[model samples]
Target: MLIPLVLLTALAVFRTAGALGVRRFDGWRVSAAHAMAVMLLFTAGAHFAPPSVTVMPNSADLTAMVPPQIPFPELVVYGTGVLELAGAAGLVLPATRRAAAVCLALLFALMFPANAYAALNGVELAGDAPSPLVPRALEQVLYIATVTWVAWPARTRPHPAAPGRDADRATGAGRRS
Candidate 1:
């Protein structure tokens, strides 16, 4: 709920900035990447947030969300926060954008089960009701799709004289019947 809103707000801001002459966000892909990075940073911060906010997951809530089988739930929460931070940084760098996008998409997929577990079991945090599974699942899917889109490589075109050289009409030197 709040996550998507954050992503959308960041996207709108970045795109508008680009339109208004911010060279870094001049393209849609760049804007989207930056927006997701902002969103990830927000989530990562939540992993370290104290148990004071009802609107977001805190460290304890996040640890409890992990299924019983997993060991050291606290460490998992912290590690994921670190991963999110790394992903956010990677997204902003041109050289690492694709890898980061792919990894983030996979991370979202892997993290869904914890969200599901928390929602299904009515795990409350900060005196708030448990998160609903359906909405959370939908949001996860949307995030996965967004990052997957970012991971797609740009298309490249071939040079004019590579292989199937359609010779110039005036010269007609390499034309094949």
Candidate 2:
């Protein structure tokens, strides 16, 4: 949504301004990785929110997105929430970042059905006004693009190693065999 777009853009700017570290953010990859991870985690947390609250799409709404044939739509939401959390964590780690991005990208693709249903049905998400079909479509496209940015090969490793960390890599003294 617009929230993620703005957040990611702000992060990229901060990185470019040298607030994040010495090695600047590579515009999309690093920025998207961190920003999307945060966004995922945010959304995942909403799944556990009380039903009385309307901060996110209601369970009934989400359930409606599932085909009637699916036995338990609530389970789907819960499961996807867990998956998003795991994926979010993966996005922040070096070894798993790329793999996570791939899976999250696929998840975004797989999630389209619900999104389409919402758009067509005029379902507002996160208390936001119902997004028009064109905007909804554009959002999907942006989601894919953000995932691509997150999944893209790191142009400059996204971020530099922590202070003294790169040196450790050179010596291997801190590592155990």
Candidate 3:
């Protein structure tokens, strides 16, 4: 819930800024990429934060969500957190944004089983009620959709002679052509 809210709010804010002439965020895809990075940073911080009833679960507490077959659950939690941090950084760079978005999509898919396991077992973290599997799965799908939208490779650089409208649409500007 919080994760999607963060992603969407950041996206809306960034996209609005782009509409207002912020060159760095002048396209929808770029804004989405930046929003995803912000969300990833929020999640990654939980890996190191000390556990508390009032805050998110720490990485160690996240071990409870791991499926029984997984080894070193704590390490896995921390490692996934590190990967999220790396993905966030990668999404901010033009050269790496597509690759990072693709990887994060896969990460969301890979992490789904843990979500399911937690739901099935009623595993609670940070004193919150266990997240229902259905909603969690839907959220995972949303994450995948957003990340893959950013990951979709551009076919080619627009030929210099192409119409600006065509180029803008290709870059996800969402402007009328």
Candidate 4:
């Protein structure tokens, strides 16, 4: 939680400073992206760990508490881990960052059920003493917000070529007189 927040803040600061192509800030931006991705991977690992090893009220804990409707908890857990790792990897690469952001957003949405269960059951979280349903929901919301902030920069579409640009002209020439 704190780890993601700190990493995101540092990344945002570095990105803002690097807007003008400051050399030192570029290094920071790259470092920050790697750091954030690694932290997210760690988070994913934590969620996928077994019940005995996983801390309480986290994703794994919630998954453990719910009655197994499916035949294979292990498979589900590991599959989610794979997605998280892949998404984190994608986030670190310039070409795949936007896709990764979408993946993460979908992941967050998929986990909402477990989050709701944790809150409803008043489960004790890893760090928190014990919290009510609303606070638990809020905690999940905060995580969602943090992840969204980190991924927001990757959401923009590339700028179109300028008017009269050669590439634009090449594509449009056949349609014009």
All candidates: CA RMSD in angstroms?
Answer: 3.9, 9.0, 7.7, 7.2
Error of 3 at 163 (Å): 8.1
Candidate 4 per-residue lDDT over residues 106-167, each given as its tens digit: 88677666556655665555645434657556655665555555555544555576455665
lDDT of 3 by residue, 52-135 (tens): 624787765578899989998888899999999999999999999888988998899999999999999999877789889999
Error of 2 at 169 (Å): 32
What is candidate 1's local distance difference test score?
0.88
Specify the highest-lDDT model's number: 1
lDDT of 1 by residue, 1-177 (tens): 678999999999999999999999898888989999999999999889877766777998888899998899999999999999999999999999999998999899999989999999998766678879999899999888888777784776877664553536546766699
Off by over 4 Å in 3: 153-177
Rank candidates by lDDT, best first.
Answer: 1, 3, 2, 4
- For candidate 3, give the lDDT of residue 165: 74
How far residue 67's Cα lies from its native spot in candidate 4, in Å, is 6.5
The residue ranges of model 2 lying beyond 4 angstroms of the native Cα positions read 9-17, 20-28, 126-129, 154-177
Clashing pairs in 2: none
Q: Is candidate 2 or candidate 3 better by TM-score?
A: 3
Off by over 4 Å in 1: 52-55, 153-177
- Model 3 C-alpha lDDT versus the unseen true structure: 0.88
Would you list the rank order by TM-score, best first?
A: 1, 3, 2, 4
Q: After superposition, how far is residue 65 of candidate 4 from its true place, in Å?
A: 5.2
Candidate 4: segments with Cα more than 4 A from true spot: 1-36, 48-62, 65-71, 126-177
lDDT of 1 at 53: 64
